[model samples]
Structures are given as C-alpha cells and as structure tokens.
Target: MKLVSFRASGADRLGIVFPENKVADAQQWGAANGMDVPDSMLGLIDKGLEFRDSMSAKVKATAVDDNADYVYDYEAVKILAPMPKPARNIWGIGLNYTEHVAESARSLDTDNKLPQECIIFSKPTNTVIATGEAIKHNGNQTQQMDWEGELAVILGKGGFRVKAEDAMDLVYGYSIINDISARDNRRQGQWIVSKGMDTYAPMGPVLITPDEIEDPHNLQIITKVNGVEKQNGNTKNMLFRIPEIIQDISSVMSVDPADIIATGTPAGVGAGRDPQEWMWPGDEVEIIIEGIGSLKNPIVDDTY
Candidate 1:
C-alpha cells in the first residue's frame, strides 16, 4: 500500500493512496471501522509492525467500499514528506555506486579508488522538503549546486549492532530523496554545510511498504532537470547494498523509528557533466524511482 502524509482541512493527516489517484484519510477510515489509528505518519510507525500489518489488511479488504466522506482527490491535498519532521538528521551513504565514485573522483580531484566500507554523512532535518516544493538556490552561498537522487530507507524498529541478515526486518518503508549539494562548499571533506542547507533534501511523493517491493536493488533510478534526463541508473550498481548499510551504522549507533537512510545516488550528476550543469531559478528537478514514484520540485532563488 502507498502511504502518505498530507495537509487537508488546514491540518496534517495520515493517508493511504489508493487506485485512481484517491487518498483516503487513514485516521477517519480507522475511526469508522471501529479501529484506533494514529493521526500522523510517525505516530502510526511508532505503533509497531503488528498494528501496521493489521491496519494494512483492513485497508486492503475495505478499500473498495464507497467511503466518499474520507476519500479525496490526490491533487486536492498537499502531500508532505513521508516523515515531515524526522526525529533526527537523515543518514546519507556516499560513494555507494562505483560509477558515481569515479565521477566524484574526477570532479573532486581525488583518487578513484572505491571505499572499503560505506561512507556515511548526515543531512539535517531542516533540509527536507516535499514533492512540488521549491529548492532554494542561494547564489551567494553556492554557485555550483548539484543533485543526487537516492532511495531512502525508513527504519521502523530501533536497535544497536543490528545484523545484516536481520536488517530488512527493521525497515518501515521506502521513499525517494534528492540529495542537493553545493559542489564548492565542501570544507576540507566535510559535507554537512554543503549538503544540509534548508530545502536541500527533496523527499517523497509516497512511501511504499516492503511488501510492495520484491527487490529494492533491482529498481531503476532516473533523474531529470527541467525536461531533460540527467541520471539513468539502477540500484544494482550499488557498491554497498542496504543490508550492509544498516549493519554498518547500527554497529556504532542506534537506529530508531522514523530514521531515514538515503542509499546514495547513481552516476551522471551535473558536476560529472562535461560543461558542468547547475540548477538556477526557473528550473525544475524531478526524480523517478521504479515502483516507488516521482518526486518533482522547482528551483527558486533565495530572496532572503
């Protein structure tokens, strides 16, 4: 099932996106069916898998019912990031794709050798913006802003030292993330300021449960700027897959519910281009991941 966090009636509510582009108010559906439901996406995730499974079953069984009162046209509501306010900064995996590593090496003037392990980075919670939102292009701060389209994993259960074999069990769902970066702002290899600027992370159109996806690694990731395709690659090219990523991070720190881990982008970013492409005002960026959905956003100049 496709789950979403949307704004309707001047309030944020949890929703389920059904066929025909309809979004059902999940809380209201639960209430009508004599089932208790959380008002927000994070609240529902915190309820654990048993509750989520039960709710998913119920939704699937009764979705065909004529529940016009709670269902709204998808376009009528404003969709927000699956986790609007993540409990912590979003975890980012760097150099996970071999081709991306090579391209990055050329752009950064570093050695092309691949990392022996997953390279982790963090994008602050403030960096997140939902689909259709504007990505702030601050000319003073960065003249070489670039995009990295990645698949983000949302953790359902918290744990330290999670084993790779059991890592999949901790996942709540998956979404798309555009890891916007300022190519020139890297200060001595540190990326927090360069990549964590406000509106830098564009996430979501919807969150797809694990049940809907058979193999995350087999999916295609395509990115486009304006109307032109920029990045076309598959998750199979990832040097470090999801399981190892979870185990690596969990070995050092606790992975908690609502914590997002972006699995890194593919090759073909603007910085890797011959002439070097950069996004400016009046441009739009769109990321499409197979089975998940499309996350599109406009680029706007920072007036303040």
Candidate 2:
C-alpha cells in the first residue's frame, strides 16, 4: 500500500493512496471505525509491523467498501514529505555510485578513489521540502547549485550491529530524494553546509511498502531538469547497496524506526556536465524511480 502525508484543512494528515488516484484520510477512517490508527506517518511507523499490517488490511477492505466521505482527489490536497518533520537529521551516503565517484573527481569535487567503506553524511531536518514545492536558489550564497537524484530508505525497526543478511527486516518503505547541493559552498572537507542548506532536500510523493517491491536493487532511477534528461541510472549500479549500508551504519550507531537514509545518487549531475550546468530561479527538476513515483519541484529565488 502507498502511504502519504498531506495537508487538508490546514493540517497534516496521514493518507493511503488508492490506485484510482484517490486518497483516503486514514486518521478519519480510523476514528470513525474505532481503530487505533495514528494521525501522523511517524506515529504509524513506530506502531510496529503487526499494527501496520492490521491497519493496511482494514484500509484495503474499506477501499473495497467504496467510502467517499473521507476520500479526496489526489490533486486536490497539498502533499508533504512522508515524514514532514523527521525525528533527526537525514543520513546520506556520498559517492556510493562508481560513476558518481569518478565524476566528482573529474569535477575536482573529490578524489578519484572508490571508497573502502561507506561514505556517510547528514542533512539537517530543515533541508526537506515536498514534491511541487520550490527549491530555494539563494544567488547570494551560491551560483553553482546542483542536483543529485537518489533513492531513500525509511527504516521501521531499530537495531544495533544488525547483520547484513537481516538488514532488510528493518526496511519499512522507500521514497525518492533529490540531494540538492551548492557547488561553491564546500568548507573544509565536510558536506553539512554545502548539502544541508534549507530546502535542499526534495522528497516524496508517496512511500511504497516493502511488500510491493520485488527487488530494490533492480529498479531504475532517472532524473530530469526541465524537460531534458540529465541522469539515467539503475540501483544495481550502486557500489554499497542497501544491506551493506544498513550493516555499515548500524555497526557504530543504532538504526531506528522512521530514520531516513538517502542512498547516494547516480552520475549526470549538473556539476558533472562538461560545461557545468546549474539550476536557476525559474527551472524545474524532477526525479523518477521505477517502483516509486516522480518527485518534481520548481526553483525560486530566496528572499531571506
């Protein structure tokens, strides 16, 4: 089942998207039926698999009943990031794609070396923006703003020193993320400032449950700027992969429920181009992943 967080009546509410382009307000359905459903996505995720499964089954059954009072057209509501306010900063992998590593080297952004271990970074919670929202193009801060489209994993369970083989058990769902970066904002060797600026992370249309996806590594990830395709790659090309990423991070710190991990992006980013393209105030960026849907956002000048 596809899950979403959308704004209705000036408040964020949990929703389930039907295949027919309709959204069912889960909170209202739960309240009406006397089910103990959470009002927020994070709360639902924290309820554990048994509860989620029970809720999903009921919601699916209700859809069959054809309830219209709590359902709305998909285009009518304002969609927010699956987790509008993440519990913590988002964990990101850097240069996890071989081609991206090479391109970063070519662009003088990093050394031409394949990582011996997973390269991890973090983006502050304030960086997140939902689909159709505007990505702030702060010209006074950067002129070389770029994009990196990647697949993100949302964990459902927490574990310390989780075995790589058992890592999949922690996955709750998947979503798309555009890792926006300001090429000229690098300070020292850290990425927090360059990549963690406000409105730099564009994520979500919906989060697809693990049961719907056969193999996460086999999906395709494509990115486009305006109407022109910029990056076209597959998850199979990822150097670290999901299991290894989970194992690597959990070896040091616990992986908790609702924690977001943005698997590194593919090549063909604006900085990797020959002439070096950058996003401007009027441009639009869209990222499409095979199992997940498209996440599109426009660029706007930052007044602040």
Candidate 3:
C-alpha cells in the first residue's frame, strides 16, 4: 500500500493513497471502522511490525461505500516525509554508485581520487523538508550548493548486528531523499555542517511498501533543475547494495524502526561537474524516482 503523511486543515494525519491515487484518511478510518493503527506513524512503529501488518490488512479491507467520498484529492494536502521525526539518527551512504564515484574522481587530483568502501555520514533530523517546500539557497555562506538524489530506506524494526539476510525484513518502506549539500563546506573538511542545514534534505510524496516495488535497487532516478534534466541514472549501478550498508552500519550501532538510511546518489551532482554549476535563488529542483513519486523544491534566496 502507498502510505503518506499530510497536513490539511491544520491537522497532521496519516493516509493511504487509493488505487485512483486519491487520499483516504487512514487515521480517521482506523478509528471509525475498527481499524487500529495509532494516529501517528511513530505510534504504529512503536506498536510493532505485526501491529502494522494487521493495520494494513484492515485498511485494505475498508470498502469504499457508494455514499462515501474520498477524503481529499491527492493535490489538496501538503505531503511530509512519510515518517517525519524519525526515531533518532539518520545514516547516509555516499558514492555507492560507480558512476558517481567515477565522476567524483575526476573532480579530485589523481593522487587523491579513487573508489573505496562506502562513504557514510549522518544528517540531523532538522535537515528534512517535504515536497513543495522551499530550500534555503543560502548564498555567501554556502556559495556552492549541490543536489544529490538518493533512495532511502525506513526501518520497521530496530536491531543491532542485523544480518544481511534479514535486512529486507526490517524495512518499513522506501522513499526518495534529496541529500542537498554545501560543496564548499565539504571542501572545508566536515560533512555534518555542510549537509545538515535545515531544509537541506527534502523527502517524499509518499512511501511505497516493498511488496509494491519489484526491485528497490533498480528504479530510475532523475533530477531536473528549472525544467532541464541535470541528472539521469539508475539504482542498478550501485556499487554497494542496501544489504551491505545495513550490515556495515548495524555492526556499529542499532538501526531503529522509522530510522532513515539514505542509499546514496547516482552520478551527475553539480559538485562533480566541470566549471561546477550550483543552484541559485529562483531555481526549481525536482527529483523523480520511478514507481515511487516526485519531490519538488524551489531554491529561494537565503534569508539568513
């Protein structure tokens, strides 16, 4: 089932997108129709995976009555990251794509550039923004702003030392994450400040269950800036797949339910380009992931 979190009429609600791609208030239906998912996605996660499964079944069984109307149009609500306010830490795997690694090499001196093990980093919770939100195009402070379109996994169960074989079983769903970065800060040496700005990470229109997608690592990812296609790539080219990432991270710390793990971006980020182009105020950035959805964020002048 396609699940989403949206804000409408001053209240935040969890919902299921009908086959028609319309919204059905899951929280309302769950309460009224004996369906028992707690009001929030966090509540559902805390309730456990089995509880979520039971809830999904009940939601699917909810019949559309002739007299009942769909709660809202798809476009009527403001979509938030499917699981906003995620449990704790947000982990990101970098340069997992071969082409991205290759392109990155060209940007560095021959002596300093080469493919290695996955480059991982963390983004504070404050970095997340949703589709249609404005990205802070903070100039001067961050003269080189770049976009990295990535596929992110949301965990359904928390665990330490998780095995690769069980990695998929722990996933809650999948969503798109725009890992926006301040390239100059990256060059300055610490990634946390460079990539962790508020509104730097824009995620979601919705999250799709694993069952809905045949292959998580094979979808097409494309990014457009002002209607111009700047990045085009596929997940099939990932150098290290999801299982490896989970195993690597889990070995160090516990991976919690609703915890987001960004799988890294493909080639074509602005930082890895010649004459390096960067985003400026008035630029519109849109990322499309086949079978998932699109994320659109406008680059606005830096107020700070």
**Index of the highest-lDDT prediction:** 1
* Per-residue alpha-carbon lDDT of candidate 2 for residues 144-164, written as tens digits (9 for 90 to 100): 999999999999999999999
Candidate 3 error regions (>4 Å): 58-62, 65-70, 108-116
Which digits, one per residue and each the tens of the lDDT, describe model 3 over residues 220-287?
99999998988999989887788878878888888888889889889898977887889999999999
TM-scores, all candidates, are: 0.98, 0.96, 0.93
In order, what lDDT does every prediction score? 0.91, 0.90, 0.82
Model 2 bad stretches (over 4 Å) = 31-34, 60-67
Q: State the lDDT of candidate 1 residue by residue for 28-94, as single tens digits.
A: 8888877788888889889997787788777777754446688889999999999889889999999
How well does candidate 2 match the true structure in TM-score terms? 0.96
Which of the predicted structures, 2 or 3, would earn the higher lDDT when compared with the native? Answer: 2
In angstroms, how far off is 264's CA in candidate 1? 0.4
The superposed Cα distance between candidate 2 and the true structure at residue 30, in angstroms, equals 2.9
Better of 1 and 2 by TM-score: 1
lDDT of 3 at 80: 81
RMSD of each: 1.1, 1.5, 2.1
